[model samples]
Target: MTETGAAGASESPRPRDSATVMLLRSVAEPAGSGFEVYLLRRASSMAFAPGAHAFPGGGVDRRDVELAPGWTGPSPQVWAQRLGVDTATARALVCAAVRETFEESGVLLAGPSTRELVADTRDEAWERDRRALLDRSLSLAELLARRGLVLRSDLLCPWSRWITPRGQPRRFDTRFFAAALPAGQQARDVGGEADRAAWYAPAAALSAWKRGELPMLPPTMISLRQLAEYTAVTEVLAAHRDLTPIEPELDRVDGRERVLLPDGTTHPLR
Candidate 1:
């Protein structure tokens, strides 16, 4: 462990459980591009991943749990098996994924029943609920129950997991999820922690990162690389994935700071 903060002072990393959603949609333009993934640039004033392009996510809320009301689709047991976590944790992750996706982006992955999905969430009432959720004054379970809706857990696909390296002031054990944008719904910049939000083709985002035009954390970069491989949203959701968690290691190589990935590749720290 580096045992030092970004300022070289000894600091212990406190990793929080988080869930991120990769929202994908099919686009007709740009001939070869099949899909676009939503990306949000965190406000520079934010405490974590400032100014970095990332997926919609945040730490799991205390109220996010298996006891949530009106959950439909795969059971928590199935989610537990897929995420390789306890049933309770699996439930929370799923709830967090749905809640955060709605909070960060205006798209809601829920409906009045299992066979249906909420098509639009742009109304003022929806915005009030979103704000209440963000402020922690409202719980997902309560919102769903009040609205007579069910969480559409079937919409989420488990993709990957990554743990922030130790020694950083803040760290996240974030589970990545992929979901196709619901029909009749559009993602709008709900601007809070993020300065801007937009959809970009996976390859184009990677190119921007490479050119230093956009900053991306390793996990974001890796996830984008993975998404770039598929031509359609169905291909991504249909692909099999290994949910093994990844924790990069920091080491000194020839007196240079470097991060060693699980695949044994090393990326020099900037």
Candidate 2:
């Protein structure tokens, strides 16, 4: 653990539980990769990782644990086993993943039934509901119940978990999830915390990061590298993942501090 503040306390703050989704789509154009990932550039005014490109996600809402919406696919017990958490916490995390994806990306992983998905959410009513969700006026459960929809838990695949390194004021124990862009739905720039949203091939994103164009945190960079290995969205969803928690450590390298990943890679602290 790293010491912080003027008093130099070694205790790190407890990380807030958060969720992020790597929304992927298959592209017809052959470039660096056949699939592209959805990314949002966080608003420069934001407090944490401002101006950095990240996925569609946010901290889990407390209401998420209190409300039980219509659900499909794997049960909460199954998700608890997959996420290595309690049943209620697992349920909230999964709900938060879907909710944040919808709140940030204008993409909803919900449908009327297990066999069907909401095709288009571009209507004015949908926009109102999205805004409501963002403002905390509408809970995911309430919105789904009103719209007669069920959260498609099967659509999401747990990819990885990352904890913010000590020394950062804002810390998040974020679980990364991957889901395919459902058919008939499009991801638009639903601006809020993000100023811009776009799709980039995993290799292209990594190259841009190397060029210092697309600034990202270690988790995003590592996830992009993993995504670069797959040529199709189905491949990513089908791939087995080791969901071990990766908490980067702050280490002194050549007298300057650097963030060290579990794989022995070091990145300069931003």
Candidate 3:
């Protein structure tokens, strides 16, 4: 049987959850199709997906399901039907997606001059406060409440969802979302979970990886390949307007190191 990364010696299982987010943007390039995607290089100290470029996201929090206000995107009922969960859960997941994105990326998705968001984005004061909050295990809900802010769920558009392949020590049932880059807001690596960050044309990023410089999980790789087909963010956003969400199950080949896609195709990992 083909082996995997540290699987033979490890007997314990890894934890997983259905949560994640991808941040995509459009670039002002000379070419017509100019959508560029943002990717973060996780710090080497991370237990999993180390040194891999990924979007800013993580698992849902208990508070995310609480459903606060200033959100005006998809109706909870619409998300409930699509997410295959109760309206409350759907709302929480959406909240989690936005909140996680903020925590991991320092990109705030919120509404009103609730004291905190306004202060955080005004020149990194809020960012400093947020960093402290993250270190203290403070809930995003607490932060919002303390600062009089509302989660702006309207900014996030549901894109795609992916589940990690079975047999992976760490698995994730990730949901991808796209947001237009906010005006006057630029992204930085924030130097904790992510050591570095960059923006690249989707097609260019794929080509670079083909040349073997970048690392990508199956879902991220496929998403970039698909995003490469479009030239602008408008096209990509338009494609998902129907809000058709895809949930793919990853199947691992028995006694060998290979994974199968729904198309009955297989790929091997290094």
Best by TM-score: 2
For model 2, the local distance difference test gives: 0.91
Q: Estimate, for each residue in 82-164, the C-alpha lDDT of model 1 and write its tens digit.
A: 99989999999999999999999988899999888887999999999999999998999999999999999999999999988
Going through the candidates in the order shown, the clash numbers are 0, 0, 3
Writing each residue's lDDT as its tens digit, candidate 3 over 101-158 gives: 7767667777564332332353666686568656746667677666767776656667
Model 1 spans with C-alpha error above 4 angstroms? 1-11, 29-31, 251-258, 268-270
Q: Indicate whether candidate 1 or candidate 3 has the larger lDDT.
A: 1
| Tens-digit lDDT track of model 2 for 1-270 | 442221222566789999999999999855767899999999999999899999999999999999999999999999999999999999999999999999998899999999999999888999999999999999999999999999999999999999988766778999999999999999999988999999999999999999999999878988999999988999999988989999887766556666788787787655
Q: What is the C-alpha local distance difference test score of each model? A: 0.88, 0.91, 0.66
Sorted on lDDT, best first, the list reads 2, 1, 3
Query: What TM-score goes with each of the models?
Result: 0.92, 0.95, 0.81
Global CA lDDT computed for model 3? 0.66
Better of 1 and 3 by TM-score: 1
Clashing pairs for model 2 are none
Q: Which parts of model 3 are misplaced by more than 4 Å?
A: 1-15, 66-70, 113-122, 241-256, 268-270
